[model samples]
Target: MTTTAPLPDAAPANWVDRYAPAWSRPWLRLGRFDRPTGIWLLMLPGWQGIALAGAMAGRAPDWKLLVEFFVGAALMRAAGCAYNDIVDRDFDAKVARTAGRPIPAGQIKVWQAWAFVALCCLISLGVLLTMGPLAIGLGAGSLALVAAYPFMKRITWWPQAWLGLTFNWGALLGFAAATGVIEAPALLLYAGGIFWTLGYDTIYAIQDLEDDALAGVKSSARRLGAGAPRAVAMFYAVAVALALAAAWTADLSLFFTPGLALYATLLWLQARRVKIDQPRLALVLFKSNTWAGLILFVGLAAGAGRV
Candidate 1:
């Protein structure tokens, strides 16, 4: 909101601008700490996975796993953002919203950004090491997806789908950490998360539609254009369906259904309000998913005592 803070999609009067020291603003901005919604978005699916896996096993979500996932999501999401900034520096310079970023604005050198990334990843690695063997393996396997994500816009119009894959890997990691095994229900949850990300990220992409086109970037928002709202609805529908399937297949009890309903209602509302012309609204809708995701997590956790 300040003249000094110019990222188009950044939260209004975010904490980073309000309170962070001037020397640390660039690094914090690089990690997107100003927009903490992304941290919740990244962490929530893993929390939901832990919830679902625990429900199926007749136990509550492991509080320690929830804590671990949050820490890991924060660090990894920061690392991923820094890496993406490094890779997309050229394209970012051409886009209005991203032009003010540390790398593109020359506030930080490339090597320094890389060093920041290394430090974040090193810390996230420490978090991952605390999880079980299966989780550690799954965490390592995700690097390939993370490494490839920056180039996705260049080669594919549906890069949001790839993000769905990358962002939702936490579901599998969470489930594995709780159960020490990957099963059908976990796969269903992961698939559902993919659709969920596709829906929400599409809304996010609307903010960049013009800039992306001008910069020769591809996104589902550009591909669908005015029909993006309808497409988002459909993607959310699939997400809800897969969530139902995951719950039913896992034998989660009746208590879980209402929370799922609440989560679905939130998505439907977001879809109804989504308009390609209203990029600011799109950003708000996209951020709202973090709360919706938490609704589903609470719903899944409720299932633990019943079935």
Candidate 2:
């Protein structure tokens, strides 16, 4: 499995030299932007929400709304990562896997990072304004969650729960974007996303368990101890069930059933593959979830377009 190497220079490298100005590379690294997996994870729930909304309305989803959601997801997810790096700079410096992150490795200054975050937020706000007023409001509300997320690990054993809330806000925003209103089905999808995040993030946290423990960081993986796999299974089970419930509540077509089943099978396989004692294996399993999310999205999109 390939992993991104941290930026090499001790001092900030020229933006043009790194990712090239045209690519906006400096901003991307500041947000761990090179990692496509994070954007996919962030965007899938929003897509699922939009598809479910379209299903509820018995219409094909607006393609423009879908495109807008994608753009918003990329910007917001990048911004969130930048915020996390700023907050976790000290903690990141202590962890081998994260020690080379832009902020901690001295490739980016804190205030400059903050400025990057503001710029990303501005871009996200532009996308938000293009959505419904309800979505725009909800998008604004999520700032509180994003602001609080970086500190959750310091104060609580379940930072993944906080992350769940922060990450899944897109579900509500997506539904509003699709239907111009928030509804019960969207709420259910958002709830399910929370559990799904818990499951996957627990697996992700497993990779950092040792470093986290040594650094006095708290996490569900450490809390679950030797029972990490069992806990992940329970979380995934709830996620699958809730996701199906969201679809059913929205009265989606039968086309969604097979996709949901496939997703369930994927989760089961992921659960079985989690090695509580092996951090690298845990990271691998966590990354595999990006595929799981995409598969689920394809199913939702298919179901949204009833023949």
Candidate 3:
């Protein structure tokens, strides 16, 4: 029997299972609404962009912009998840960890999944249109990356790096939306966010290393093998350095330094403690990046205030 129980990666009592109507459960599952970490991770870069732009302006980020990005992020992330599931339905069926997904478990049909993707993207487009011309153009351009991301794992060993590009596109868009122009700091933040994704997504991929190998999937975790923790540390180090450079370029005050320090420490702890063999431990460490992102946002906002 196909169980409606929470999937392995989702929290035991996630809202999708707890509150979503039975008829809507499959659609919600397709979007990963139950696993909110992905949503946070995807949204943080945009938040950072807005915060960084606020620092550049020596003012606070616009609350309306935050609300817009928040709604937009959730919609786009849901679209991305549905599209990925559509593309990977066969592969998902073969993997133990993903076999229970709605599509693989026969809870949702492929045509229905595609229709859901279209609906989510259409809604997200309305939010995207609220931004300035530059941001609107950049937001539209990101669709190509989103469309191509699902095939990256099949074609390259470094699909995580591709994810870094696709996921961090919002950093650029947010900056453009806030400032009406892309500047050096936004570029730096975009670059830094790529490395950040590299580090965290590598950690996330650790949970699937065994299954990915059996399924012939490629990932940084499988590429780095047992050296993943050290490599993650290196990636985090580069990310911190680039972020500091972004702060410097934006003229954010020294107050940003301490937050950077704390952010670095968190990444260090994750790198030092994560066990490639322990999928649960890997997941815990992966989720910790939300705090890291928040610390950076606070640093940027405070630094801007003092400046």
TM-score of each: 0.98, 0.91, 0.97
lDDT tens per residue, model 3, 1-307: 2448789989898898888888887788888888988888888888889999998778888778888888888889999998998899889988878999888899988898889999998999999888899999999999999999999999998999999999999899988999899999999999999999999999999989878988999999999988999999999999999999999989998878888899889989998998789999998899889899889878777778672
Off by over 4 Å in 3: 1-3
**Cα TM-score of candidate 3:** 0.97
lDDT winner between 1 and 2, please give it.
1
Candidate 1: which stretches are off by over 4 Å? 1-3
Clashes of 3: 0
Candidate 2, residue 2: CA error in Å?
A: 22
Which residue pairs clash within candidate 1? none
- TM-score: which is higher, 1 or 2? 1
Error of model 2, residue 49, in angstroms: 0.8
* Model 2 spans > 4 angstroms off: 1-26, 305-307
Enumerate residue pairs that collide in model 3: none
Looking at candidate 2, the ten consecutive residues that score lowest on lDDT are 1-10
The alpha-carbon lDDT assigned to residue 264 of candidate 3 equals: 88
Winner of 1 and 3 under lDDT:
1
RMSD of 3: 1.3
Better of 2 and 3 by TM-score: 3
